[model samples]
Target: VTSMHSLLQSATFLPQLGHNPLASGPLVLTKDGHIRGVSGDKAHIFYGIPYADPPVGAYRWKAPRALSPWPGVYDASFPRAACMQACAGPIIEECPQTVSEDCLHLNIFVPLEVNFSTPLLSSLPVLVWIHGGDFIAGSASKPLYDGRFISNFTRTVVVNLEYRLVVIILLSFSAVNKSSDM
Candidate 1:
């Protein structure tokens, strides 16, 4: 039997000729171009996709900017850092310990059957999940929020976005001043 990795590497996510409908492969595309993602029997996983620019430096206190267009296909094969937050004692390990202002990333889980040729009406429904952290802690990257199970069962697209919580709230006032100065 061919190994799953080889199968994934060789196949593209589409059902077009030269591709296998059942094979897991790199086959998703964003407006920026192609994105390398992983596929399961029922779902295609694309993680760490940046929906906005990092809110660092001058942008810290301002509204999110559009993600600058990248020159080539982005590798959405891995998870990105979660937003900055104080660790919750014993629960710290569960947190994506690494923190950054550039944590405005998201994950996408697409059912294998949903493809470019799928009609809008026949297209899979989408589920946008906002993780529960009391608006202070949780992240979309958390294990508790993994979208694979739901995507498979519902045959839908699941998108989970990570965003700054406490930091953004605290900077609201400062952002106003910074913007006025610009």
Candidate 2:
């Protein structure tokens, strides 16, 4: 029989650290299906988790709604497309090459030591970082937004969330305001 310690050390053992773990190891089942994240020595990172359905097509210009579940174990190891925005900076390069309307994603970093046996109230506090973009453009994928170093140092869980930018969301609000003025 595999020793418990060895099993714990196994890549598949989740120890119920956070969310629901699937049987495939390093894989979690959220409200959606199985999601595979990356495991670091200090923390387990889940990236590009969708909180809402893609704000495209008929959903465009509408408030966010529940996210539709995906079919398979979604690979969440990489960041998704940043919210739609014009390219800036010296190079003036657009991120992801293809911006999408469905860019509502979040990245979560959890300390490796966090486990179910730990008291819920005593568990490490979670810090959520909302990157500043002047309400326009920024992404959780940016280097300045990385949560790994701080999470390791503080032994705290860190979350980075992405949302629609000013161009997309503000335009809709302005239209509504104009209509209301009439």
Candidate 3:
């Protein structure tokens, strides 16, 4: 059994004794737009950054389209909703309560020691994590996949991405079948 203390300690989302991101979040400008993220003791965490436009309406069952540059700073302090999926058994606890079709976002974790303002002398290794749920139910937002611990310990940049899951896949198959029958 995991103790609450240990769970809290392991949680990368919880801010530690260092920088207070609430007062002034760390800002990073990306092609899509500027993002503001939170800073923990060991890592600077950017959460729920959309890589593509929301897959809805005509966009559904199609390849994800590139996102347009947002007019203002995108607040990335909180994790976004998980892709629509049914949660069951013990795995349910690990899943986000809210789910949606517009969930193709990624979280980035950078070691706090790396100064983003200055040019890096050397490039840090990157670790991209795709959550496992047999291509169905897991989410990058799950606390189990939080990358702060790994980023700080290994001095590497970590990224966790969300992808369309079971329902979307099934719908796509159904659409294909229907179109062929037409």
Higher-ranked by TM-score: 1 or 2: 1
**Off by more than 4 A, model 3:** 1-23, 180-182
Candidate 2: tens digits of C-alpha lDDT, residues 24-93: 2256555456667777766777788777777788678778877677898788888888888756785355
Where in model 1 is the C-alpha error above 4 Å?
Answer: 1-24, 89-93, 115-121, 172-182
Residue pairs with backbone atoms closer than 3 Å in model 1 (clashes): none
Error of 3 at 58 (Å): 1.7
TM-score for each of the candidates: 0.76, 0.73, 0.82
Q: Which is the winner by TM-score between candidate 1 and candidate 3?
A: 3
Ranking by TM-score: 3, 1, 2
lDDT tens digits, residues 32-121, model 1?
455567776667778887777677897777777776656676787777888887667886776676778888887878766655443334
Which 10-residue window of candidate 1 scores lowest in summed lDDT?
A: 1-10
Number of clashing residue pairs in every model?
A: 0, 0, 0
Per-residue accuracy of model 3 over 7-115 as CA lDDT, tens digit each: 2222232232233335477776654556778888778898888777888987887777766668888898999999988678887776678889998888888888865
Q: 73 in model 1: Cα distance from truth in Å? A: 1.0
Q: Which 10-residue window of candidate 2 scores lowest in summed lDDT?
A: 1-10
